[model samples]
Target: MRFDTVIIGGGLAGMACGIRLAEAGQRCAIVSQGQSAIHFSSGSFDLLGRLPDGTPVTDPVAGIAALAESAPAHPYSVIGAERCARHAETAAELLRSAGIRVAGDSRRNHFRITPMGKAKRTWLTIDGYLTTDDADRLPFKTVCIVNVEGFLDFYPEFIAEEFRKRGVECRFGSFNHPDLEQIRRNPSEMRSANIARVFDRDADLEALAAELHRCSEGCDALILPALIGINRNDSLELLRARVGCPIHLLPTLPPSIPGIRAQQALQHRFRALGGEYFLGDSVLSAETRGSRVERIYTANHGNIPFEAAHFVLATGSFFSKGLLATPDRIVEPVFGADTEFVPSRSEWYTLRFFDRQAYQAFGVKTDPALRVIKEGKALDNLYCAGAGLAGFHPVQEECGAGVSLLSALHVAETILKIEN
Candidate 1:
């Protein structure tokens, strides 16, 4: 198959890039082996939550400017502050068009409640996650944390305890669902994904909504876990019909239902925009003509050749296996691109486990145009985005989705310009 662009990895970056191209009448394909990091995301897209000095960021736009000055090699810096802000707006608009409601933009951050009842500052969060306007403290009079009975991943009591310690009016409550009883009996069915499947049914959602309606009384807002529905918008609509108050969801454990919904929404949008998505398939090898990669071979479809005018690599960090870490060094696996990292492995980690680690910032070396560079030579037609591009520490700066979305959008525009 031949296309305008072929993106490797079906993560946020890849999907965003493909969708942008597909929307612009360019044929695009995303080859994905399995689930992306979106499955484990908090469903909140953060943009510079904290500074390099561990100081919490108040104004994210200002923070970006400061970041550009401090970390010029960072993806945000390479993308430019004004362009990063523009891409941020573009990402929010793109997700909104995909039926997801993002609450913030590049100007500032939103504070959402975590599973542990801690406040998290994020740039753009899926609607119904943040119950309060205050990022530092809970702004509600009475908060009710609802837990599904036998849901092991969520801890309502723990959240309640934290809220109480902070002198906030909060209560912990649990509701029993008929569907959960059977799932709880089986060990394998105890996962968030399994429970989310059960909730996907309209009857099951209505039943849970009914129970929540009865349990939550005189509470300012209902703080539920992120497992409200698998279909996201549909599930949220089903519950909203029965429930009376505003509801917010705390980020759940792995196989995050909201995350899955977000990922699916982007992929579905990409397909709807005339983009092809090959799931359960990975790029095996690329045959480059001089500095350009003309065709790529896939693991599942080895014999069939996939060709594109431009290529984007959004395979992600070590967690996504985009960049492999060895005892001595870290390497970009796909193109053997020169990676940004410390010379010695001993400098990869720091004494403070929670602090920014050098390894987190390790990824492929790229030019201002995001083209992969090895030995100071640029891979002309190939571009890299998301966690695969080196420089900024995602966890420390809380710019995971920011980098992914912004970089993808910027790269897509760059490709368009190059086409022109």
Candidate 2:
């Protein structure tokens, strides 16, 4: 197959780049191994939640500017704060255009309630999920934390305890329906995704609405786990119409329904714009001519190769197999791209688990243009984005989605400019 651009990973970065390129009349294709890190997301995108020194960031634009100066080799610094700010606006509009309604902006950060009920700073949060502009204050005084009867992922009592600490009159409630009993029979299968499948039907939603209406009689709002709207974005709206009080959702543990929905929605948007999507396929090797990557061979297509004028490596960090950690060194597996890591394996991590580890900052080495470097030479047609790129720790800095998104946009814009 031939395309204008062939992205190696189908995560947030690859999808965003493909969508941008396809929208501009460039033929784009993406090869995905399986699920990406978005599946474990909290349904929130972070820009620069905290500085390198652990100081919280209230203004993301300012934070990016500070990051550019503090961390010169970081992706945000490479893209520059001016372009990062512009790309931030573009990303929000792109998500909305793809039918993913989100709240918050690039100018400032908002607080999203974590599964443990802690307020974490983030850039964009999917709508219908709880977000407060101020961490010290909540919009509602009285609220009810409701959970499915047998769902073990969400603990309403823990959430209620946190709310009470904030001086909110919070209470806990449980709802059960015949439709959920089948899934509840197996503890392992009673997850957010499965519960969302049951709630997709109108009959099941109506039953849930009736139960919520009874539980939320005098409460200011109803807080539930993010278990609806997996297949349909309007599931929450439909349930809200049938209930009395307002409804807000809190993210659950892994197999996140909101994350899955966002992934599905973005892929749908990319395909709708004439982008080719090759899911469940792995890139086995790449064919390079001089400094340019001519084509890539995948596991599914044994002999045939995907040819493109430009390529993007968004395969993600070690967790996604974008980069491999061996006994002596870390490596970018697919194309043997240059990576930045500690020379000694003993210095890779610290004894404290919560402490910032050196390995989190290790990834492919890219130039100012975000092109991947191999043996001291930059690949003309190859670029790197997302967690695969070196510098900036996502977990420590809380800028994973921000770097994934903004860097993808930067690479896409660079390709478009080169084509023009």
Give the TM-score of each candidate.
0.96, 0.99
Per TM-score, the best of the predicted structures is 2
Q: Which residue pairs come into collision in candidate 1?
A: none
Model 1 stretches astray by more than 4 angstroms: none
Question: How do the residues 304-345 of candidate 2 rate in per-residue lDDT, one tens digit apiece?
Answer: 999999999999999899999999999899999989998999
What's model 2's overall lDDT? 0.92
| Candidate-wise lDDT, in order | 0.85, 0.92
TM-score of 1: 0.96
Candidate 2 ranges beyond 4 A from true positions: none
Encode model 1's per-residue lDDT on 1-420: one tens digit a residue: 999999999999999999998888899999988899999878788888888778888788788888877889989999898898888888989999887777885776777677787778888888777645574467666888888877788888788877776667887777777778888997667888888888888788888898778767888778888876776467776676688877778887787877898999999899999899999998878888889888999989878989989999999999889999888888887788899889888899989998679999889999999998977899989999898999988998888998998999999999999887
